[model samples]
Target: MKKKGIFVISLDLELIWGVFDKVDYKEKSSYFKNTREVIPEILDLFSEYNIECTWATVGMLFNSTWEEWKSNFPENFPEYQNEGLSAYAYGESIMSPETEFYCFAKEIIEKINATPSQEIGTHTYSHYYCLEPGQDLQSFEVDLKKSIEMARAMNIELKSLVFPRNQFNSEYLKVCKKLGIENVRSNPTDWFWQDTQKDSLKDKIFRTGDAYLGPINKSYSISSLKAEKDKPLAQKASRLLRPYSNNKILNKLKIDRIKSEMTYAARNEEIYHLWWHPHNFGSNPQENLKDLQVLLEHYKRCHKEFGFQSLNMDGVNKQFQNILRN
Candidate 1:
């Protein structure tokens, strides 16, 4: 009998400007640009494993940056016009267009499109915060529609989505379905600010918490200044202890989490959705990648023992839909 396992790797592809609007891009472009090198390495690794992964890219990244690269640097950066740039430059206002930033992002988007065996998904038009209660549903819908349209403009077909900030609004699911999206990567109950409806059996859910599987603990908080100050000690300890914390630990803990939520999936199995920004790997990417590699290897081992198989978000949702039909 084959062991049951599911592996879902979701990427939130956005520029540092989109994430950190406060930073001065003109002076700090290199700092923001440095973080992006890890992305190609990640793509390479996924390619090596023949991994079918989901890239929840910000549509503006493609339209703005990629388009610019094509028009501005056609000869030297032919790939940039279609592929996507490593970084982008944007202003303070969220909705405002920053042409320079778009130029960079467009190249990056094109590059991602060129990669084979990868699925491009939606992250939202401007990386909106859906969790903010004041954000009206209409506005959310409009932005969601815009994101889908932007992808269409790029001639890219979007099949999956991962909410920005893990802010899964139930209403957004309807928007996704209407847009022909087949699946979404959502947070599990154990993560912070999870939705009450997420516990229901009807929705397709994925568990996500970086610390839970890696050197850190899910419960650890970094919000407080005090916590940040004290984290170095814990970080050092985690580095020393990580080698000993093997697949056995991951299997035991992750399986228990899945079993607890098995009923929510109606025993059909829920996607163990693991996701994070590619930039997150930048701080100590090699170490982070090593940890991820260990987890992936463990997932492969588990696939042989359990019945679960690794899937991109679309593949997982298709399987779930098939199960529902029966």
Candidate 2:
């Protein structure tokens, strides 16, 4: 029997928490509300099909924020500090501890955990940019340790990590290994200075869905000068042209690319790591989720027709480790 391509869906899992820290509550709520409505639908589809996925959650989201909110506002908040909804509801107050955003995140994590086929992993404590020269490696290690510790507090055994901004620092890998992380997702493409280490490794690096499946042969023109506050006429025209040029065509190209990559992986019996942020679906989540559903359905059909088995990070690592030992 021919080996099937390994299908791995890695969700960044830090949607609102990551973005909310930067953007105001109003805009964040709007974005998260859209995301919340879309994700559960996708999760339902994945569950129905028995598709396995890995959610690398931000550690702070799991415990600290709730605790901090509760500690700060005890009387108003009745639930546990960390308790929040899995999906943010529409028109939620940004200041309230009872905001639907936290609740939604919690619910999703619980669902992911309850789903037998799904796997949960850690992204980091702060999802901090350790690649910047200013950030010391020791601090990065401590932050990662804290992330794992947070997961442990929740009784989640952290196994895998996805570097923030796809900015991977080699020293960070050592921290991951020390923390008992089995695998770390590294970029497969060449980067100038940020993830330059990725270029050196041939097969050790794991590629994600966006890298392999995002739009191809799409030309985008942007204003050379940073427009002040107003949207320039030329910029608006370019923006209008971008969708017609790249949206559907790029999506199709990405799907085709993923199909080809899967086929190649199947032939070689190599691991094909397909990852993407759950929030990538934020803009047009339904469409992106549908794209994901189509890919997963293809994977399921291939698994049944061939001998392919879907493996999470742990399974992938064990297989690779077994191969290494032999």
Q: Residue 90 in candidate 2 has what lDDT?
A: 17
lDDT of 1 by residue, 1-326 (tens): 22133556677787653455445455645544644666787777777665677888875565553444233221121112312222222232322344354223666677777787678888876566665544556666666676677678778888887667666776666666766776665454443334532334423232233334432222111111111211111100011112113456763565444333322222233334456677566455676676666555555555544544556766755654454456
Top-scoring candidate (TM-score): 2
Cα lDDT of model 2 by residue, 59-88, tens digit: 656643444533322112112222232112
Off by over 4 Å in 2: 1-4, 20-25, 64-104, 191-246
Q: After superposition, how far is residue 211 of candidate 1 from its true place, in Å?
A: 2.8
lDDT of candidate 1 at residue 293, scale 0 to 100 = 67
Clashes, model 1: 28
